[model samples]
Target: IMLVSVTERTREIGIRLAIGALEREVLLQFLIEAMVLSSFGGLVGIALATAASLALAHAMQLPYLFNLQINLVAFFFSAALGVIFGYFPARRAARLNPIEALRHE
Candidate 1:
């Protein structure tokens, strides 16, 4: 269900590109939006996970890695994910034929 949604959205982006939009522009637009949304969602998940982990640790009396912090690795992972995920859609958009794409609906 989710994959279908993403693909359909990507196709719309491709149509935009077919009309002379730059590949990077389309990619960046989607990537930025996705990152913004994902960041908010990830933060919420992180907070919940942190609280749950703390409670679990206390209950189970287990050792914990208490110094958890975001780092360069996390940044890189996020960027890489954005680029990697965005690349194919951007490429498809770039390859569109304006006439054919305009005919798609």
Candidate 2:
């Protein structure tokens, strides 16, 4: 996903670099995009899991417990995974030569 993003936005990155955007800034932009995407997915997953668990517990006449710690851990883990996975592509985007990227067809 990150690679696709970087590849798709090569021209944008080149324009940004051409316009004097710093490498770290470009890197940060991609990193933030990845984290947001992962975090949103994680939140949706947690919501679905919670709803399903609640439905099952009610059907079984059992207590439904929402484990905050587990949810937090999962969310953070997903965000961390995004950062780890995104770093490579972000680094690559940041390192792109403005002329070469702009000339990409």
The per-prediction tally of clashing pairs is 0, 0
RMSD of 2: 0.7
Over 4 Å off, model 1: 1-6, 10-15, 18-20, 61-65, 70-72
User: Where does candidate 2 stray beyond 4 Å?
Assistant: none
Please tell me which predicted candidate would have the highest TM-score against the true structure. 2
TM of each candidate vs. truth:
0.60, 0.97
Tens-place lDDT digits, model 2, residues 10-84: 999999999999999999999999999999989999999999999999999999999999999999988998999
**Which pairs in model 2 have colliding backbones?**
none
Overall local distance difference test of candidate 2: 0.96
Q: What lDDT does each candidate get?
A: 0.60, 0.96
Q: Residue 53 in model 1: shift from native, Å?
A: 1.0
Among all windows of ten consecutive residues in candidate 1, which has the lowest summed lDDT? 1-10
Give RMSD to native, each candidate. Answer: 3.7, 0.7
